[model samples]
Target: MSARKVGMMTEDELIHVIRAAVREEFSAAGMRVDAPADVDEARRDFMFLRRLRGWVDGTASKIGGAIILAVVSGIVWLIVVGAQAFFNKP
Candidate 1:
């Protein structure tokens, strides 16, 4: 294997190399890798917002579903108990 000296690289070159390596790693993990020029500040901000919105939507739906289920079960139990009491009257 050939060896290169890290100290010989300029700061910018070292940074670029590290960035490329990290990008490759994420790409290998099946993520869509956008070119650096394609991802401006606006794109980054939108990505963050989109992810946050998705999280909030998923959590809210789960909570709402649980609340609906509890309310329905409570209503059913009350109806059943009221019917039994009325029928069992002496």
Candidate 2:
């Protein structure tokens, strides 16, 4: 089919052209076009997984920070006690 300029196309023709272009792109990318219901289900699954990953990453970062802080505090306490003992030696 000959291509018509967008300005020359009716609404229906524009819509049809747009849909055909989209389908061609999808096929070229090796992607399957799903039905509406399947698309909705896939979207839900993707969102859930994304949220779960974010939560796990945040929790891990917080736990790691807490552990590092505790280790540093312990080292500081030991240094303070050692310094006091060294200065008080008779």
Among these predicted structures, which one has the highest lDDT? 2
Worst 10 residues of 1 by lDDT: 30-39
lDDT by candidate, in order shown = 0.83, 0.84
RMSD of 2: 4.5
Clash-forming residue pairs, model 1: none
Q: What is the per-residue lDDT of model 2 for residues 14-85, given as tens digits with 9 covering 90 to 100?
A: 898898898678768764455777557657877999999999999999999999999999999999999999
* Candidate 1 lDDT over residue span 54-74, tens digit each: 999999999999999999999
